[model samples]
Target: MRENEGGQERPGGEVEEPFGFWRGGGAHERVATGFEETPFGEVWERFLESVDTTNVGALTIGYWGADYDTHFVYPVPLLVEAAASFPNLRSIFLGDIEAGQSEISWINHGDITPLLEAFPALERLKVRGADGLVLEPVKHESLRVLRFESGGLPAGVVRAVAGSDLPKLADLGLWLGDEAYGGDSAVDDLAPILSGERLPSLRHLALDDSQFQDEIAEAVASAPVVARLATLSLAMGTLTDRGAEALLSGQPLTHLRKLDLSYHYLSEPMMARVCAALPGVEVDLDDQQEPDEGEFYVEVAE
Candidate 1:
């Protein structure tokens, strides 16, 4: 199932998609817009004199329509002075502009840990609209995939990634939004990644698009990071059936291989008992909306 180039499906690899500015590891380049009639630091100094940031790897700084409320393309000190001429940079995706450049719950992020400590061989990081985002407690030594695509994700950026110290993190996603777009983040502010004590070589956990998704699926089915996930996305939340019966009454998740639970609400007898409680996993219960505005909701608010 080879597909890559953002046409996705690379279960194996040979990936290199992103174009404009450039991209590498999980490549992503897309920077050219209305130019807001030019002069946002001279269009990032003409995108730093037309790329070739010494073999770029990933970059995206899209559309600042209406100059993002008075020229807001901070570009973290021009991408940390262009990550010292990017000798094969790791990854970065910031404000890839959507909701027509305004309503990814009102984009306006900043204070990005000085380009994550000026890209100390950054591994992967994605940030979409989190309203003046910032970070502290960082301890990166070869960071690995930490994404935040907000429609409102802030409780000081989920406690600054549960007090950062990413020991080779392995893909942790978040979009817990809707405290009127600043998403105050409480479920006791995700008690240190739901008691997994933060990414311990995590294998892909997406606590996606939330409104507390059944209290984060009963605390991620008794998470000690769900026994080190293989892939466990709680896709586009508002998951009903009391959160798929608190994710089938916990414990035996059969060492999950995949369990997306897409755009949920679950009823055809609890989505057929959550696909017979994962009969060899791979269960992505697709778009099943039912109850109108009274109950089921999380597809992204605001």
Candidate 2:
């Protein structure tokens, strides 16, 4: 999927603005920055000098340069080294590059484990793009929200997240995209998460944008984690009548406040049944899709 806009909203309801190289008059809670020709270091240094980073609670990293697909190893180190400057930093959005700069599958990323290591008090982390992305298993107590938006999320990253220890984490969103890019994860890979053994405080969970949406839906139907979650999302995938049937036949989802099945391939009767079944729940059935030559497709695959 092609992202056209920048991060407009952040955790804790903060508005984000584009980082200005020339020192602006007022301070902002959240800011986004990117570079075209200048080195990332220079832009970062200038941002530090110009903006009062101590007051900044959220930061968004945008396009690095024209050669971002090739040269993608510098930004992580710079952020880790400058962690001391952002004492109040809690939320960070990496790889905010849009479709004009680079496609979601083409945006290159490096090991992001150091960021979690450096920022022990960080609460929210959202990353876009998944090419060459790596996230080693880490233990952090303060993290509350973690989301990954990708056309193809690697199985290694998913396993690492499942293995990691985050006792206080409450929200998790994973886009298990198409296998053609790098999303080779099977339904078995998510057993730990579906079991709810590692994430004790999780209330909101999203397993979205997958080619194997039907299999995931079947697995999720009886997952133990469903009982504890307040909201569950299976949106932006190739979910059809079979997956809906599995959900309807499985454990009662009446406890959940919301069920998101947007951008799906479900039939009209199935959609009606879902809504009728979950009368008290707010079900999102927007963006209904149709098959192309008997082939159903996920929403965000490249």
- Compose the digit string of candidate 1's lDDT tens values, residues 108-195: 6678888888887888777777776776668788886777877678888788888787878876888786777777787667768756
What's the lDDT of the predicted structure labeled candidate 2? 0.83
TM-scores, each model vs. reference: 0.36, 0.88
Q: After superposition, how far is residue 62 of candidate 2 from its true place, in Å?
A: 0.9
Error (Å) of candidate 2 at residue 241 is 0.8
